[model samples]
Target: MSICILYYKMFMFYSLCLYFLSLYLLNLDFTLYLELNILTLNSISIEMIVYFDWMSLMFMSFVFFISSLIMNYSEEYMMDDKKLKRFIYLMVMFVFSMMLVIMSPNLISILLGWDGLGLVSYILVIYYQNVKSYNAGMLTALSNRVGDAAILMSIAWMFDMGSWSFLNYIDYFLMNKEMIWVASFIILASFTKSAQIPFSSWLPAAMAAPTPVSSLVHSSTLVTAGVYLLFRFSDLFSENFMSFILYISLLTMFMAGLGANFEFDLKKIIALSTLSQLGMMLVIFSLGDKMLAFFHLLIHALFKALLFMCAGFIIHNIMNCQDIRFMGSLISYLPVTCSCFNISNLALCGLPFLSGFYSKDLIAEILSMQFMNFIIYALFFISVGLTVAYSMRLSYYVLLGDFNMMSLNFLKEEKNQMLKSMMILVFLVIFKGSVLIWLMFPTPYFIVMPFYMKIMTLLMIFAGILLGYEFSQIKFYYQNKSLKFYHYSMFFSNMWNMPILSTLGVSPYFLTLGQLYLTKMDYGWMEYYGSKNLFFLVKFSSQLFQSFSHNHLKIFMGIFFFFFFFLILSFF
Candidate 1:
């Protein structure tokens, strides 16, 4: 109870602070950097650095606000759990870790937060004490370890610069060719942390966590950590490196959007949407509009967290049923939750006047303006259509379809803490976009484009709604299309075989390498020429000494006779 109160206070405090800080920063047009040196070693300063700017403050505000809501929601959602206190403590630690990442500009400090997030999130993922949770936690931790290693490499690579504060040296990257390696390492770290492309399997697997933990991890703390890191280092990235990020992010966007449509699990669908939005943010950031990406990140956090909370409410009421196929006509029972869910879902699809629209629409327009190939244009729009299509499909299966759950199910609106938290977000989901666009962009953006190009967003959205309803239609007379192409659908539904590639496809080589090292290096040569030979040599020497001690009398008589014989021979 005390913790809940504290979080609520912190949320209010951060929101107030963010408003004033944004006003001050916008008016002053300045940034504050503070470094407290702990020690200087070999001309390199080991220090704690904090960067105060509008961006970091804004991010912190969003994180704190969302975390507070999740915490409050957890009070009800996790009421029956045994270790609720431990869960609360872990949640607090998770938020603190994210705070460290947001405020620190130094690579070393950022890594402290980066590693903290990875470790805490792993614990959270496996909170259920099940085999599935354990596997999911392992996947989350191991995947994040790749990013952690990248950060370590970046730190070592930056050793020659005599400073671990990469933010201070962004301009000097061009002066030294080796600094690009540092950028590459940071980008790699961001990729694994953000779960981009090859690293994406962990995000959905992480749904094994409690819904509250999922709300925090998927929405703000874990997945966004990667995007936030790269947002800070955007200036250091070269065109070639950014192109790589662009293509990877584009594919992630399309793949996630496609995957969400096929996914039946409620939380996994939300997780995939988060991935798609992350790709959208990265796509814009790679195109050299980081502030736009940050804008979307802040907005996405609000709705995504709320979406998870709504899903959690439904799952809780339905006795832990997560399959949307078994959950139809939720609107009849959970009108408030259904309303919030649809609003956020449309916001995700960039419905005009919602928070997501202000950033997503701008991203589409800016992307269209970019000089790119036909493939890029097609994927971007198709991904957008997929986003809306999946969202609509989800709404159909979960809200508008026939009731498929057992007759004993009694679902209703959670009217206390859970509803309060979600209602707050519902307000933000509606107005925050317009509010942020006005504050962030004082002068309205002038977009000059043809009529057809202008209507492309609406066109795709309308088409997606139609396609989603068509896909959701259940005609018993017709053979199931998905089962007809079972193998192909499975591939798409399984994140294009990413989970298998990450787990089954990759684990064998690592296991084989470990076995080889154990046999050839650790247990074989080291055993023979190292420990085993030394043991035998010591044993033989000790035995010889023991034999000599046993024959001491005979050895002494032999030595005397040999001396006498030598004297006699000399006399002769």
Candidate 2:
């Protein structure tokens, strides 16, 4: 067998082994450890600090399980792509980084894994290397870097405060006044990583990547990093900070809902909805209710992954288009894809009797408890309404309209692969919630819901769908005359006069000054000539000194001298 084939087979076998190993480990009654490391710093100790109690275990398992499915699906999804080897390498790296992040024992280790995953995801996002993909990669990288810096700073602060370990930090953070700032910094990090609100633009741009990349990064791993961070550090956030976190969550939820309405591209719509769902997860976390947030994360991952996978099937196979406006009735021709998409959409809309309904309803209930007032409650209600609108709009525009197969030659084999992947996702979306409930809370009383709240939520979803369908039917037209008029009227009106002047005038002076400095620095001739050869011999000797100073050892000594001088002066 070829080396590549052997490598691929070995990787598949390893992944299968890990999956079964994780399952077996989950069944064992592992003991929990919540203690600080008393050993000295820099010791290479292997301590098993169990952060994955029942709650964290639930989310971690979900992440790993879904990631395995996506990885399996990708084997077929990218079977024909030219860069299959590079693709598999990055994909496996991404999955491994996520696993490390979820199971990390220390904050520093987790952040390291998180940043590694972010880097790999950027590579995957810009894998195509076209102009649009390049821009998307840069944007995602810059935004994620900002988040990474925040997290690094927070970690530094924690270590400086004598809490180098996760358990130690949590215990200290619960009562520390500085925790408010730390928590705020962490939330900022999460917001950027999760693509919440103003940071959300890059996510839609990221759709230039392949559909499988979108499914894995947007749905399951990269975008969800922030939410996972918040859940991991819930104890660190003070109540005061939690209030602000709640407001940020609400703002992101509302803005994402609005953006989704205005988006025409199908992936963009799903991207916006991802932001909205993440915001909801933030809301649950901000309530200081770990169990509820954990549950929400589990349900969100399954359904969102399913939704993205189905969308991928449609875009990759059925229509070969990512714009909702261009797609029409795929129900008859791609029934499996349509059915999977519909179920996932319903879950996203929080329709009754679906997995999304249970988890989202729990979030709403927590919000009500946290706010307990008319204004906040009503705002959440409206946001939930918008969620339903976009979710239904997505379903209606793509699946229910008149059939429009743009080309009859769309690949049937690819369509079959897409359908098979969607079926796997669909099965998970249908049953994962029940499994979660069984494993986490295995009693009837534990799953109780208030009757009136359920009814109101159901009504809200129905009303939003009704409004969305009605809104879709109304047509509006734009005149080409307006575009021509704007082009003529403002073509030269907004030119950058200041930049033009700077280039013509100010920049030349600075450039000349820079050149003079460089000349003086590069040669000692100016100093020798200025001294009129009075110290010509000394100047020539100085040239020897300069040449010697350029030696690496002498350069190191010079830097050491400079630092030592500064240290002495500061102390004095």
Q: How close is every model to the real structure, measured as TM-score? A: 0.91, 0.76
lDDT, candidates in the order shown: 0.89, 0.70
Q: What count of clashes does model 1 give?
A: 0
For candidate 2, the TM-score is 0.76
Looking at model 1, the pairs that clash are none
lDDT tens per residue, model 2, 46-131: 33354544444444555555655666566666777787878877877887777667665576667777898789978998888898
Tell me the lDDT of model 2 at 488.
36
Q: What is the lDDT of residue 274 in candidate 2?
A: 80
| Model 1 spans with C-alpha error above 4 angstroms | 474-484, 517-572
What are the per-residue Cα lDDT tens digits for candidate 1 across 1-572? 46666776777777678767866887688788998998898889998999988888878878888888887888888888878889999998999999999999888889999999999999999998899999999999999999999999999998888888887787788788888888889888999999999999999999999999999987878889999999888888889998999999999999999888777899999999999999999999989988889889989998999899989999999999898888888898999999999999989999998889999999999988889999988999999999999899999998998898899866766458899999989999999999988888888878888888889989999988987777577424234655665556678889999999999999999999999999998789888999888999999999989988999999889989999999999999
Candidate 2 — which residues are off by over 4 angstroms? 1-52, 161-163, 369-371, 405-415, 443-454, 475-572
Quote the lDDT for 311 in model 2. 77
